[model samples]
Target: MKIGVLALQGDFDAHRKRLEELGAEVVLVKKPEQLDDIAGLVIPGGESSTFLNLLGKEGFAKLKGFVRMKPTFGTCAGAILLANEVENPKQVGLGALDITIRRNAYGRQVDSSIREGQFLHDPIEMVFIRAPKIERLGKDVEVVATEGRDPVMVRKGNTLAATFHPELSDDSRIHQYFLDLVTNGKH
Candidate 1:
């Protein structure tokens, strides 16, 4: 299956490489038209506000529409964009997933860390770099994993979101899970 990674900014390259390693056709999506050719999309971690600014109105609207019709996975700041509500003010998002996110909830970039946690069916090494935390989840949202007392991974319908960077880690389970979602016609 072909999966697209939003290459507007952030760690899109890491995600692209990971998905490719998983044997999926990886597409680097820069323009709006590229969004149509992929079965699924991944929005990587970056500055949420800056990423939003880069999208402008047209790009943002198109992305929102695409997420509604396909399987989408978002990480870190990307997770914030997918949420229905954004905490810590500056409210900006695509509202693709029914949830609330708080930016930099884990502290600053200097406070970034790597922690081991069980997400899904395996132990995952999570890298939290100024990541947002899932604060409030909707009824349809299923908490897939957690870091201590906080929810780190959550899924709603065909959309999946994580507060940490799984691409940066050795584990490819998350990407594989997303691929499974697409291949299984979950979207």
Candidate 2:
């Protein structure tokens, strides 16, 4: 199967490398048209507002459409983009995932750190950098991982979002889980 990583900004290369390491054909998607060829998409961590400016109107519309139909995994700023509501200065989102996110809720960039979070009942390393916090989640959303009482990673249908950057860590489970969702067509 093929996976496309959003290359408009941020550390998209890291996501590309991780997906490639898992034996999937990876595409650094720089254009909205690229969305048509990939089975799944990975939106890497970046400035959410910057992504909006870069995507413009047509590209944003294309992305909004793609995420609704295809399996899409988003991390950090990507998570913000996927949320239904954004705070700490409201912003429009794709509404792909039923959750409310607060930008930089974990604190400033200097406060970034590595911590252990529970994933599928097992402890996993999570890297949070200027991360958004999942404030409120809709009933359909499942908490896939958590740091303390906060939902760091969540899933609902074909949309999976992580407030932390899974690609930044050594763990393959998170990415693998996303791949599984794509492979099984299990939302």
The prediction achieving the highest lDDT against the true structure is 2
lDDT of 2 by residue, 82-105 (tens): 998999999999999989999999
Model 1 worst lDDT run, 10 consecutive residues = 116-125
Model 2 C-alpha RMSD vs. true structure (Å) is: 0.9
Q: Model 1: how far is 172 from its true place, Å?
A: 0.8
TM-score of each: 0.96, 0.98
- In candidate 1, stretches whose alpha carbon ends up further than 4 angstroms from where it belongs are none
Give residue 38's lDDT in candidate 1 (0 to 100).
93
Compute the lDDT of residue 119 as modeled in candidate 1. Answer: 83
Clashing pairs in 2: 157-187, 158-187
Q: Per-residue CA lDDT of candidate 1, range 3-90, in tens?
A: 9999989999999999989999999998988998999999998888888888899999999999999999999988999999999865
RMSD in angstroms, candidate 1? Answer: 1.3
